[model samples]
Target: MVNSTQVSYFTLTAYFDTGRLKHLYFLVVLTLYILIISSNVLLIVVISVNRSLHEPMYMFLCSLFVNELYGSSGLFPFLLIQILSDVHTVSAPLCFLQVFCLHSYGGVEFFTLAIMSYDRYLAICYPLHYNIRMTSNKIAVLTAVLWVYPFLSNVFLVFVLTVPLQLCGNLINKVYCDNYYIVKLACSDTTVNNICGLVKMFTVILGLIVLIIYTYIRILKVCFSGSKQTRQKVFSTCTPHLASLLNFSFGAFFEIVQSRFNLSRLPNMLRIFLSLYWLTCQPLVNPVLYGLKMSKIRNACKDLLFGRKIYL
Candidate 1:
């Protein structure tokens, strides 16, 4: 109601009066959280333990799984607490931390997918040179960049742009902490935040789009010209990667639409789903997509759980 600095807690108005059914909702959310954690951790452990599966692609997958855990941790616990409690408010410091964690998850996820596409491009287009180009050292460095760049960007957004702003109100319409919504609440001028945010979003999207498009186009060329064996190889590996990319993009599109546009006319249920979709679905879906689609991961998971040895 006053300044942003004075608003130490933000009231989340998006949560409805669930009444007695709050228990049921809590159970459902808890179950989903458990599933996400179990599945992602399983895949990460499978990749790390199986030395044979520690190639560039799977290693990047390990990083992806780790980010899923990171992102899910930022939201689910908060949701569970709010579901049971009457007051749906979060401290400003905790809110900023959540924003940072979730934003970094999204950025790292996108960057990781782009790098995975490039990895596929190399393996398929230049099989002989894939190892030489995507060496262990280079893979480590690229992985580091994906995490570091996103963290720094989010740091700028949350700490530099948002934390210092004055607020006229403490009500956030959505369930979780969002950088966009936080920026929107600024009683102070947000000209720089808007301009910088748009530029950052467009620059990242455009560059990654070009990279993904070029890699896929080249991969397609190799697929058609190469032998049946080559085609099969590309199909197996690239299928899961493409599936993951499309899945994440769909959820992310809904999120961006809700953030950028005025969608308050929509049902609260739909709006809440739109806000949670990207963070919730990606973590749950990725492990399933990769675990079931990638033969080695599938077998490895089975071997880990069922106590049966299988060769990759």
Candidate 2:
């Protein structure tokens, strides 16, 4: 029964209504965010300083780390503010920017993962040509394309779909600003927006997943065909990246599916928890998994932390 004009004036507000759980959630998330920042920053520094990590795989990893940092920064600071102040109000422009950054980073992340898979494929399946194929210039071009393409996609989405919407219910069901939540709040029919979102999600998730799988299959074939020592070495090298891909894939899937389903009936606290898990936890898991499961990164980190220089 609310008029469009009234909806324009209205704003969504979120707060921690739970008694002790809110504090506990905030503490846990804050701690995790700190760790994410520290670990990713450390990784970037180490990779930059360590000459041995200048190869394509590590370069891609560094790029992923940078994107993860940006992704977390885009989502977590606003979330923490909302949690602490018990105010989740966001202006329309700010909300759009939030969605833009989120999607931009997400799209870039998808491409980065795909590029990483290709890097592994080259390294494993075409070892002799790997250096030539994944040279510094080629890597730079790939990285630039990964970032630019996503930015353009988000820009197109905003202009073509979101700009025309009329605001009805200003409340975004989820904690952070998301494309679907914003579209759902539109007073006007959002068929086009929803369709665009679906198309982009499908193309990015399904298409990229197919590519990653194909690349990995080829990698496996090459690995198993090689000597046992080579096979083991390849497996060890790829295990950490595989873990990262799994973490990212699950998180992306969860976000896309959750956005499609109308889960407004769920409690706000639960929604907050889910959002935190999807956005913050996924990125945090990457650094932890890489540091613990990858011997090179772990030893490098140890040396850096202990003020010892590790050669290679």
Candidate 3:
């Protein structure tokens, strides 16, 4: 109805009329959201209340859980509303806000995992020196960087680069707002935006990947050489982190591919699943992975749920 510069809101063209079944879809999404909130909150509370879980590793995990909640909150509420509402549209400001929140979530998630891997490497490789190396002050600094970097970076990019873009269209062909798609919709010359995006992908995102890989390689080197008991200990500690990394990586891969390639040929439901996978799966899977795999978290969660005062 309007040109790019005149656009005030975006039409999410991906959503179709689910008819009366939308109520069922709404119920399903609501239930899933509740589960994510409760599970993530549960772990955060468990770690916070249990003095035994106040270690550096658990502290990192608590941050991860909080990030999951932060990320999920970006989409799930808006998703529930869109599922029920006939109009699948969002104001430009709200759309930009969602993009900011989601991007910050992703950046923090990756850096947190990277930090966790380094923590693992220290604990396994250095052992006795880990405490000295990973002191409270160091942990606090690392934590601050992970949270603040993503936020500052995202807000700057969204507010400065994205918010001012002159879009050619307002139709966002996804279930939710994405910065990449919004850039694609821009009518103005986006050479600078494109350059910045590529730089970010290769530098910030790739740097985190390399850091994680380097830490894991060192850990694995130590793992294979250590005694069987040591190997088991490493396996127990590293399994959840590896699983989480792989899960998030897969979803991110799908997202990057979908944004770059022609994925419109896929079924609408399948496409929707792929788009939402990274955001939804991580929040759900992290709690399960950390809770079930780590005995400490597992026992803490069990005691909390069953009203038992026992601490393992």
TM-score of each: 0.96, 0.89, 0.97
RMSD of 3: 1.6
Q: How close is candidate 2 to the true structure, as a TM-score?
A: 0.89
The Cα local distance difference test for each model comes to 0.91, 0.78, 0.92
- What's the best-to-worst order under TM-score? 3, 1, 2
- Candidate 3: residue pairs that collide: none
> On residues 3-108, what C-alpha lDDT tens digit does candidate 1 reach at each position?
7778889889999998999999999999999999999998988888887898999999999999999999999999999999999999999999999999999999
Badly placed stretches (over 4 Å) of model 1 are 308-312
Error of 2 at 213 (Å): 1.3
Candidate 1 local lDDT, residue 144: 96
Task: Write model 3 residue lDDT over 1-312, tens digit each, in one string.
Answer: 234446778999889999999999999999999999999999999999888999999999999999999999999999999999899999887898999999999999999999999999899889999999999999999999999999998887898888788877888999999999998888788888888888998999889889988999899898899899989999999999999999999999889888788987899999889889999999999999999999999998898889987445
Candidate 3 accuracy as lDDT: 0.92
Which candidate number has the best TM-score?
A: 3
Q: Which residue runs of candidate 3 sit more than 4 Å off their true CA positions?
A: 1-5, 310-312
Ranking by lDDT: 3, 1, 2
